[model samples]
Target: MNLKTIFFTIAFLASFHIFSQNTYVFLGSYNRDKEAESIQVYQLDSEGRLTKVASTTNVINPSYLTISPNGKYIYACTDTKTPNAGSISSFEFNPKNKTLTFLNKQTSGGENPVYISVHKNGKWLVNANYTDGSVAVHPLLENGIIDSMAQNIHYSDRSIHKERQTRSHVHSAVFSPEFDVLFLPDLGADKIRSYAFDENQKKPLTETQIPFTKTDLEAGPRHFTFHPNQKFGYCIEEMSGSISVYTYKNGILQQIQRINTHADEIKEGFESSDIHISPDGKFLYASNRGKENNIAVFSISENGFLKNIGYQSTFGDHPRIFAIDESGKFLVATNVISGNVIVFKRNPITGLLQKTGTEVKMENVSCVQIKKYY
Candidate 1:
């Protein structure tokens, strides 16, 4: 074959490989009755359209969900009221049958578990407890089931505002880019605390851990997102509905900017819920609940700053969290109270979102994560 012919053949093969991958979206629903006890799954096409693939499985109050690194198991946090009595469950994911088989359940170490994220090595599972303000690290068994707690840290910093920042309320727990430090966003403390992690040797961490605190006392930081390049991080303030950008270097975050999520003249009572950066690191999206329920979009400037682009109505009330497809063509915003997941088409060039009118019926959807399988 000629030189040009060989180059064309290689390009075509690379494009074909990516197109053959099947993407799936997992929705985590909170069932207070503890009857259904499962998660919902949907299939995503190349164009980012979703089709129901599997019915809801049996799991309990899955407030947050995360997939295993090998895609063999799924983990979730059950938001229960009993103090230090919530749970984290594991399931075997069957992509062919689009079903989940129960594996095991382990104590979450705290009450009101809100978020769960797995370590990069897939050996540890981290959880954020909202009620008691703690972070738990659980180990995974060889069979892909949860084993037990590796480390459980109880935050006692009640050193901020009184109304909202009375006690330490760990809202989120995520690993740094190098996986050397684990950062926990505590809403009630108005700070994001960082701890040095040792995966090889299970050791105890001290209370003198480094922390990042917001200027406003009642800001109530909720969710945090890391840049694709791993050089920057962004945290959304739930109470004040604002975004804080920081420079992440050597497991430390230095404040860069704090931008408001709501318009200056149009603020009457709103709280932020979820915050996510685009797959390509070009845009950021955050959910605002309360009187103004909308998803605010922002363009990432050259210096890693967020420039407010626009806001799109979620078409429902209380949009807690949303997920973006792997292809970056669609975004599904989960409306917990409105009982629907509003689908929107995302423009790649402009980083703007347009409603697609593709709504999925769901009850109390709080979290979503996308997975791709052949």
Candidate 2:
């Protein structure tokens, strides 16, 4: 064969080798009142089969987790420290045994760290501290472990209502698709703060900080989901159990629609929990925790509008987080109060979910995240 043909054959073989590997799921559990909590690992085979593997070798209540793009490392938020200050821990996963080893830990610079996210380039780690109303950024070492805090910012703003928006509560911070902006959702402030992501600096250039387009005086936005195409975004409100959808273009947000997650009426103490979009960009799902513990499904239009499809019971109480497998064939809901992870089969075409008999046993499971591995 000629030299060019030989090069083409080698490239095709390398691509096929990487594609044959399967995906894995990592479940981060929060043991609120207990010690010695761990990160659970599970493997997903090519046929969509799940097999539980060995748990992480550390003891920390990792309420939230963010995996690296190359699938080499995972960073978890440990929120069980004193006076309520939080910490972030790093781990190295071994696909041979499907176990993780502790690498390092650093202070998150705040309290009740609820969410963790890594930049697409795997260079920076960001977190949302719920209780202390702060955001922290850290630089990741070449070995996929956190080095230390690079920047920490305490957010302050006006609280319109006394009931829910009494103080500042930073729930989650997520990077935009282009990695040029960071969206900070503060539940207590009832607004999403947008900041320009600086490529040359460690911290965000807050001089360009801009608030949400449609502010809910007391709606309490908790989590956000970006569309697959990166043209639009949606946020779920914890105070009112509603979703605010917006169009995002050129780093600006334009309000498109706001829809309620509840079917009929919301009672006194209802609060929404988590929001996620389908892998195919055809549906959106949000969890509601109140007298009724259920997941509301909404169909997505090509123009990025949402329409309510139906609701399904979470099977257990207080379904705080749910994860859709990478193949979009399964949805697992983590019922925090009930200590059960209920699995459901999802119909991608119809956007309907069917409950599967499989479930996992864990104590105070707060977050579920899945990724593919060999």
Candidate 3:
């Protein structure tokens, strides 16, 4: 072959190798009968198909999962409703084998731990317990093991909803983009509470003087996501089926706008579960569970307000959680009631999702997270 032919062949091989890299998809599930593994791992191809790779048994209802910022560890909040029975488990992730090695488990400081987030620095792990209306922080050892609880805060406030908001129910604990603040959304209290986070300190978080931004009575803030610019935040209100946009500065949140997630009239039983912003920050997506069973798509304006674009059917039931891959090429929604995960191909320009014809059957799948591994 000529020198030019050799160069072209080398370039083509290099591009093909990069395109063929597989992605690791981690799933968290609610295994009530102990028949299914609580955590499972799958390999996702470039076309969005999933093939099971590894699974760990006996995790006992690991309904939510989060990976460390460095991608070295996986953290899961075990949903146990008994008083003080809830716990968080740590696992050392091996990207080579697509397996998780159990590290150690610790008390989650309350019951029914539903959500967990690791600090950007990977030194701390924070979780929310829904049943007992509490949030806890745990120190992380260098080896991916979790130390005893560093702090646990409980709430007693209640909202106007008599049946659902009878008392405080903390749903999500997330850190700001800069890691200077932490936001805990209480679904039962209708409040998005903020705390000053000092990663250098032993505890690392304390209630801010201007502690919280309260949503409308019975709004039931469940999960929140910050815009890529760090200038705005969006909270998905579970009870009201709306998204609240807020101006965020120096750890304080000021509500700016509240818009419905459903395209039609707001009806009962349309519960919103999770919210995520596209990697490019041009679009925002939220999963609606009950009667709608679809993912709402919105265009994010330069000023951070959301414009409803459209909705895409999840092709399953009760989409409790959904994740957008880092490349922005694929999206996956986990249907907890349907026991399946549906994948979609995203239109980057229009911000719409089309079913990719890729589905994986897993019993009681609740959370889906994706990471690219070479």
Best by TM-score: 3
TM-scores of all predicted structures? 0.91, 0.90, 0.95
Q: List the residue pairs that clash in candidate 2.
A: 22-373, 23-372, 23-373
- 1-374: candidate 2 lDDT, tens digit per residue: 99999999999887545433456777777765434456787765433445787676455678888788888898899854446568999898877666788898999989888899988888888988988788888989889889778889897664787755667899999888898888888898877887787756866545463555445767888999899899999999988788999999877888889898887766556578899888899999999987778999999998999999999999998998888866677788888888888778788988888877767778888888877664
lDDT of 1 by residue, 1-374 (tens): 99999999999886645543467788887766556635888876555566886754556688788898878788888745545478888877888777777788888888888888887788888889988899888888868889878778787776456676779999998888887788888898888888777777665233434555444577788899898989899999988779999998877788889999887776657588898888999999998887778999999987889999899999998999888776678888888898788888899999899888678877888788887775
Candidate 3 lDDT for residue 88: 94
Q: CA shift at 142, candidate 1, in angstroms?
A: 2.6
Off by over 4 Å in 2: 1-21, 32-37, 45-49, 80-82, 209-214
Residue pairs in collision within model 1: 37-58, 37-59, 38-57, 38-59
Question: Superposing every Cα of model 1 onto the true structure, what RMSD results?
Answer: 2.9
